[model samples]
Structures are given as C-alpha cells and as structure tokens.
Target: MGSSEFQSPRVIKAAGLPYFTPANNGGAALNPEDPSTPTLFRPLTIRDVTLKNRIMVAPMCTYSTNPDPSSPAIGALNDFHIAHLGHLASKGVGLVIIEATAVQPNGRISPNDSGLWQEGTDSEQFKGLQRVVNFIHSQGAKAGIQLGHAGRKASAVAPWLSWEGKKGSIRADESVGGWPSNVVGPAGGEEQKWAPGNVKYWAPRELSTSEVEEIVQAFARSAKLAVQAGVDVIEIHGAHGYLVHQFLSPVTNHRTDKYGGSFKNRIRIVQEITATIRAVIPDGTPLFLRISATEWLEGNPVAEKTGSWTMDSSTELAKLLPEFGVDFLDVSSGGNHRDQKVEPHGNYQIDLAGQLRKVIQQAGQKTLVGAVGLITEAEAAGQIVQGADEAVATEELLAGQEPKADAVLLARQFLREPEWVLTAARKLNVPISLPVQFARGLL
Candidate 1:
C-alpha cells in the first residue's frame, strides 16, 4: 500500500483512460499516484457517515434462528451468524447489510427468520443485533440491517430444509417444526402457491386498514431500535415481492382503500414508513430503500396481462423518496409475481438503476443510486463504482444513459467468497487494507 505501487505512468495512463477522479475527493491528478484512492477504493459519504469504500455486502437471508412463541422469533445471533458475517466484514468490505429481518412476528418469511419486533433495550433480539453491529465496526466495515415483512410469502421452511426434501412438503407444520400460526398480505384473494421441489406455499390472510397501520408503526419502531443498536445504515426491504412491494404493485394490491389504488395511494404506506423512521433516527444514519424497480410482468407479452409495477413507476417513486428522507435507492427487480419474466444475465438490473439515477439527477435531488446483479468481475465492479465501462460495444450501447451506479452491492459473490473484495483489489491492481492476521496468507 505505497504510492510507488501506482506511480508508474503506464498504470496511471491505463487507469485514467476509463475513470476520472471526482471533484469532491480531489481534482483529477495522476502525477503522484495514490494507491489507496482507486475509483473502487474511494470512500463514499452518505448523510453524516462515510464508508471506507463502495463495496457493500448485500443482505442475503440465512434461515437460521430459534423463534419465540409469543413474539417474532428471537433471532439471537449465535456463533454461526457471528462467524458468517464477522468473517466477511474482516475481509475489507466497506459495508455489510444484514439479512431481511422482520419488523413484526407475522412478517417473517420463515419461522426462523431474524426479527427486531420485540420491545425493551435489553431484549435478546436487541442485544444480539448490537453484538453484530459492534463486531462489524471492529472489523473496519459499517453495519446495516434490512427491515422487511414477508407478507403473503411467510411460514415456509428454509431453502436448505426444502432442498433436502426432508418431509416432501413445503408447509412447516407444528408437529415437524415451529411454524408460525398465520401469514397475512395486502388483499384477500386465492392464495398464490408455489413449491419448488418439495416446498409448500401457504396463502395469507388479507390485512385490514388498521392492521396495515399497525405494521407501518412496527417498521418505524424497528428503525428506532436499529439506530439504538448502532447500525450505520437502515435499508427498507421493499423489494422481492415482500409486504411493501405487495402494496406497491397493482397486480397484487386489489384494495380500494387509501393504501391502494392510484400511484400515490399505493406508495402511501412506504412513504409514511420512511417519513416516520426519518423523524426518529439521527440525521447521520443513511436510509436506503430496496425496490424491485419492476414487476417484470407489465411489458412482457407472454407474461400475465396485469397492470403491474413498472420501471416508470419505480422512477416516479424514486423521485419522491428523497423528499421522504431516503438517501439511497438500491435498485433490483422481478420478485413480485411467479409469472414475471427476467433475463438472467450479468448486470441485468443495472439498466433499471441507471434509469432511476437519471431521473433523480434530473429532478435535482442528491439521492444516490446503487445497483446489484451479476456484477462478479473485478473490471465490472470497478466500472460500476467509477461510472465508466471499458468494453467498447457495451459502452457505446450505454452512451446516453446516466453514469453507472454510485455503489454496487454484491450478494452471491460475497457468499461464495467472503474475501472477494480483496481478490478484486488485487485483480484491479489497487492496494487495499488486509487484516494483519491474514497478511501471511495473502503473501
């Protein structure tokens, strides 16, 4: 990690060709190279907090928990969770967002999903999460948590359990395990069921207006607790067909009440939740909203012919989010319906993020945008952080698009290689801080 490592004119010329240093950090100067200040390695400041780098470990669910009968399962962090997340933080990630944690008991995707719904500062859930936050900070990475409600997609067995075909059933029965008593959603219709392999799907009871209000309050309360627990970022899990997404998409929300119908009404609940959480949390804590960007059903000819959530709608919502105090938009897509079609390619959803970023910029908002998809290559990830891609053909294709995402969030890649960031730094010829204990291994 010396300036000499990047001082070679050849290396400076090569790096300067694709990426330009932003005026915020320093004027574009390649004379005496700074090895620690590569585009991907540069710090990102949101609100009052600054990430050491742009690489973020996206929240991925690990259905390992023991639920309480009276409250949301007490998702106390055991040795397993600590080891799993702590190792990643120590590997040089700038930020690590924990999995989708429920705001209420019934909001969990599975009986074993993590939760922060319980009251009291000394609650087991609070203490457990605080320990995680402290550990992540100790490892030189910021900690974040995604607060979510599964809505109609609740009470299922873990993916691993289902894969094992243990009982050849999708439902988690009380006799077999501690299955939650009930699951609820936006509208009362025929329950949509899908059991890949032996997994079972259960229909959810429709939530009433009062119940929806209660859930909104639950989210706000959870945000307050997350702040108290010392998390640096709080992401609202509004993506992947979860409770908030259910209300956002017209395909699922058949409600005629204030929480549904029309664009403004559909986005009402999330708006209120954002505003409420903003009011409680400190101004320094960055607020993130993860949205599906599109339901992937509206424009597809073969998909179900329903009025669904679209990119245009997401852009509209992105415009309003900054007004509601959201600091970043984590753009992802296609989890609202079973019939929705998605092309599984590298950077598949990056276009959606680009679209929203342009809209937000044009609206003169300071909100940042993040993209997450199959960004597995060091070059690709660097391009995202630098807002420039080197591939001539792809670059031409994106000529008029807004600059690439401000940050890139990685999920599966981190799962596969917790030290992916370190590997990426090496591949990009960028110097990064390696844990002293692991320095020998790198050598």
Candidate 2:
C-alpha cells in the first residue's frame, strides 16, 4: 500500500500543546487556486453529507444501565442518552455514531442498550437520540446510528455486572427439553426456549428461515424509526458475532440452505437487510456497515475458512454493497470467534483494510472504505490514506487518544472526553478551533 507519502506538516505549539501546521495533506486541507500549490483543507463530502473535518466519534455503549424505568434510573433514558450523545456534539466531530441500538426487544445485547424496535421506542426511549442529532447538527456534525442484533451472543451479562444473570441465560438443544428458539415466526413450536451458550457468550437457538425474515423486517422497521428520529446516516452492525455476524460465519451458520452453504449465501441476510434498510432511509443519506472481517477462535460460529467475509470478502462486499446504495465500509475483525489470530500492534488489521481497498480499487469499484483498529499516530494514519494502492476510498483510524486515523473514530476516548474533537483541533492547531464558550472550561 506504499506509494504516495504525505508532506509532514511542521508541528507548532498552540494553547500549550503541540499543533500541526495545516498542510496540503493535513487533516483539513483546501485545494489551492494555483497549480503550484497543493490542495489543503478540502471539505470531505460523502453522498449528500459534507463534513467540516474528517474526524468522527465512534459508537460506544457507556453501559449506563437504563434498562428499567421502574428502577432507580427508570425515567433517565432520555436524559442519559442525550447527555452522552450531546457531549460528542459539543466536541465538534464531523460524524458522531450513536451507540449500537437494537431493532427488537429480543435482539438487544442487554436490556440496557438503546433501541428503535417499536413505534414508541424512539418517541419515548430515544427522544434523547433526536435531541442529540439536533445538537450535532447545530455543531455541524452529522449523526449516525449503528443498528445491531446480537444473535447467538444475545441475552448475556454486561461486563460491569456479575457474570451470572437469569435474564440472558439461554438453553441448548441437548440440555433438558431441547432449545426453544424464540424468533418472530412460529416454526420451532416444539421447543419454545432461548439459545444456549457454552461459554460466556450466548448461543442462540438456530433461527428458521421464516424467523430470519422476521429479523430482517425488524431491521427495516428500525431503519424507518431512525429516519423518523432524524439520523443523517445508518450503519448496520454485521460484526463482532452479532445476529448478522452469526449468519455470516461458517461456524455459527451450519444451515443447508441458500443463506448458508457459500460465502455469498451466508452473507445474504446481512446484504438483504442493508438493502431493505437502505430502501427506506432518505435517499442520499449515506449507508455504512461495520463487519468483523474474521472471527478469532476455533469451533466459533463466526470463523471463516477462505471465501467468507475475509479481506477478499470485504473487497467483494465493498464493491457490491454500493450497488444497494451503501457509501462506506467500517472494517473490524475477530468477534465471530474468541481465539483469533492477531499481531496486537498499532496497525495489525491495517493490512486487512489496505488489502481490501486494494482489491476493491483494482476492480474499479466505487465504494468508500475505512479502518478502525489501533490507529494512534497522525503520521501513520496519513501514510495509509496517501499510499493506498487502489482508489482506497477514505481511511479511518482510531486509537486511545483518537487522532491517528485518516479520520479518527473513537469509543473510549469520546466516553472519557466528549470534547475530544475540540481538544484535537486545539492540539492540532486548526483554524476552526473549539467555540470560545468552551475555551475557559477546556483546561
């Protein structure tokens, strides 16, 4: 992926921290009228969306525990989600992804996750989401939602809580009265039970074809809700061993039907779901997806052999998704299985992303792409964007402090510091610095 190298900008100090001198290739570069001057600070536009800068806030669950309104924080749903998302808006990220929300009550990873399942779910449970989007718009940032369904992994204990919970416990096919699969359809009438998990993650009852269709409809319903909630983008979560991931992985989906045998079939559900949602969302509002390029462990349902959602799969998916109207690809891996093969460095999965871009670019595909692993240093992030062998779409790198990617996306960083974009702008010495109202309180 090495070809063009960025002209490193001279670093300067502003507000007591080192800042990058805006360059032709700096985070925000504008094209020069003169041929001799390189383009610098150009506005980034995706579909009908244009961002002031490439920086974005990645979706993250604070595990705020707003599950029961009758509980201590029962009525705090709107307040919690609004404050959580509003903080990112205040920070000035170009894009802010609200946490992964479930499309159905049973699809949620935990009872606490934000959702848009029913008609009133958003109106009541997520009035906060709209307020957050309004806040982001006020700050010139586009708001997106990461819609997800935890399949076999559903109904499990949250990390913060004790590992033992009766609510999320599932049942296996062999244990006692057999697995009672609970899906929207009534195919598995014999056993009306939940899925079972041998390990910590839940192993949901294998869904029937009819049930899968119901799940697909649920996603479409959620998309309509998102549109009603005023979201600017809709990102489907097909990664990290969720319901869609379960169907995509060979280990999890052993079905002998059209949705299982081949890589294309396994990914059919996710692909169709994307298309279904895309059809309903406002035209031109960019559609993006996050996928676990590979699952980590053995016997794990999400693992791949060679043809499935690997880098090759990603490239193919990237190329094909655009036909259905997707705008970008968020690359991630290792949730299908627990024991994944990884280098554990700053840019290990970068090769996967870069390789995917190479394939897509070589094929002359027009889909935008992004990376979201250990991207911390600005220089390294810039290198990937500059040197991508193919027409590499856009690069998105995220790290702890959140400024290393072509466009940084962060979860923990935003949770810790909602105004991180402001911090980044000041740290990088951008002209559109944080509003003066926050200047006094920033320090």
Candidate 3:
C-alpha cells in the first residue's frame, strides 16, 4: 500500500476528432487517411457534430434508476449510469446513447424506467443527465439520448422481475408504483391488448386527438431539456412498438380521427414530433429517428385483412424525413405486433437500412442511415460501413452499391465487451489509441 507501489497518474486528454462542431481539444485519430483502415473507424460529421468513428453504442436500458415511492430522484440517472456509460466512452466508442428515456411519467415502460418529465435545469432529472453528459464529453465521445413513450406498453414489469414470477403489464393498480388503468394506446379495448391471449396486460384507453398533440409537445419539451443537458444528438424513439410505433402501424392504430386511418394520418404524429424537436433544439444539433422498417407480417391472415406496416411504407417515410429536419435514420424492426413473424440472422436489419439508404441517395438527401440488430461481429460491421457486398441485380438500384448504412449501432454486444472498439481495431489489424494508464497493456 506504499506510494512506491503505485504508478504515477497521467492526465488523459479527450480522444476525439478535430472537426467536431464547437470544436474542443479532444484527441484526433492517429491515421484518418489510411486507405487500409476500416470504414467503421472513419469519422463522420453530421451537421455540427463529428463522430470520431462509426461504432456507436446503441441505447440499451439498464433499469437501474430509483423508482421508489419515497424517492424524489425517481427516473434520474445515478452513479451506475455514469460508470456504465463513462467506461464505454473511455474505451473509445464513438457515441453512447442513453437508454429509451420516457418524456413523461406515464410514458415509461416500467416504474423503474428513466424519465425526463420534470422541468427546469435545476431539477434532479436535468442535473443527473448533465452529469452523465459531462463525463461522456470528458471521455471524448458524443452523448445521445432516446426520448420515447411506451404507450400501452407502459406500466410493465422490468424483465428481470421474472425472478419474482411476474410477467407482462402490471394490473395491480399502483402496487409497484405503476398506473395500470391509465395506460393508453392508439386504440383502446381489451381485444387490442399487446399480447392477444395474455391476461397480464390491462385494456388500454384510446387517446383523444387533443391528447395526442400533448404527447407531441412532451417530446419537444424533453428534447429541449436534452439539448440543455448538452446532448450532441437526439433520437426520437419511433420504433419498437412504442407510442409512436403504435400510431405508425395500422394493426395497432384504429383511430377514426386525424391521427389515424390513411398513411399520412398515421404518420402525422411522428412528423409533428420531428419538426417540433428540430424547432426547439439548436439547428446545429443533429436529430435522429429510429423506426421499425416493417412489422414483419408477410403472410399473416390478419395482416392481409388489416394491411400492415411494410418496407414500402418505411421507404416513403424515409424519403420525407430529411425534409422534416431529421439528420439520421436508425433502422430497426418487429415490435409492433404479436403476429410479426421474423427469424433473425446476422445483420438481419441491415437490408432494410439498405433500402432506405438507396432512396435517400437517389433523392440526393444528405440524411445518414444507421443499421442495428444482430450486428455483433467486427468484420461484418466493417463490411456494412464499407459497402463491401456485391451490387444489387435490380436495374433501378444500379447507381453503384451504396454502403449498407452510414453507421452501425450495437446494443447487447457493447455490454458484453465494454472495450469493443479497441477489440474491433485489434481484430481488423488497425492501430488505435488507448488511454495512457492502460497503454502498457497494448500488445
């Protein structure tokens, strides 16, 4: 325990690119111009913020926030978040997006989910997020947060609660600090419950057209707060069977009002949310939207009768996002319906991203695309960013094989390997920087 047994501490400068918007002294890459470098390691500039690399840590909820009835800090990030995200940033991840944080209390998927509902920069929610953002910045990685509303999916038990033999939505009326009766969806009814035959979920109430507008405002308000917290990027959670996804999918959205019916009407809420967030946040800050490209209801008889959300629908929406002030599209799929039949394989979601990218390229939009889902391998990640696959045989898509996506987002993989970026660089045989304290471990 003597001082002689300890090594001298060295100051670690931020490790990032020089072109970052509102530039800082973050460290630059050792060799950005090396043609042999993998595309995953290249820098990408979206609006004013420039990411040092394409490897992004996708937002995966830890469900570690304090949701106790006696605690005023419920839904605020804490020490666990700081250590978790900070550790990843320090290891050289380009961006670390916080979990799907609820914009309003009722929007939370579980009582324990993170939230940004409280107002003012002085609030615990704001202060906690600001602390996390500061650490992410100090480590030279851009911080991002996914703002979402779970809708009918709200008030559910955390998956880990399975150890207690609990499953699905909480129907015990605030027994665990959840509001089972207040759960709302695009359509209301017992028949519309998420899981067709499960008695665990409460029957949802249909949100009034006016209430839908309020939810849109909540999204904008939360986005404004995120900007205040110094988030470099904001992604609207429009995918994964959340509130927005409920409205997007015809199977779930059965409203007769302006917020429902035809394609334009169904997407109306998303359009408003995107434009509102853009208006509230600084123009320099980039906005991203995550969407379920398809409901994967290809042969379902119910889907055939009701019509389903498909890649074609997503393509149309993707083309309009650039015009709606969205800077990026994070493509994911299959969480809206129980009938969604999908057998996921490696890079299963990248193909949908490719379809959207092609449309964006043909239209000459500058919007970037990010692919997610089952992308766990370093070489496959490299090929996606590099467009290493063969060209498409379709004549309309013959404008050279565009990269499958501009970036790759991995969620679970990063949890399993906090230093994934470092490991990936080693695997690809490319040189990368390590923190001076850990430099001795570099082989």
Ranking by lDDT: 3, 1, 2
Q: Which of 1 and 2 is ahead in lDDT?
A: 1
Q: Quick one: best TM-score, which candidate? A: 3
lDDT score, candidate 2, position 316: 62
Backbone clashes in model 3, listed as residue pairs = none
- For model 1, residues 116-213, the per-residue Cα lDDT tens digits are 98887898888888877777776668899999998877777677777786664366656544443467788864544433333466766778999999
Q: Where does model 2 exceed 4 Å of error? A: 1-42, 69-77, 120-122, 163-199, 296-309, 386-406, 426-429, 440-443
Query: What is the clash count of model 3?
Result: 0
**What digit string (tens of lDDT, one per residue) describes model 2 on residues 131-185?**
6566555554678898888665555445455335534433322232122243322
User: By the TM-score metric, which is better: model 1 or model 3?
Assistant: 3
User: Which candidate number would show the highest lDDT if scored against the true structure?
Assistant: 3
Q: lDDT tens string, model 3, 166-230?
A: 55444434878878788999999987788754545667899998899999999999999999998
**TM-score of each predicted structure versus truth:** 0.86, 0.75, 0.90
Q: How many backbone clashes does candidate 1 have?
A: 3
Q: lDDT per prediction?
A: 0.77, 0.59, 0.83
| Position 171, candidate 3: lDDT | 42
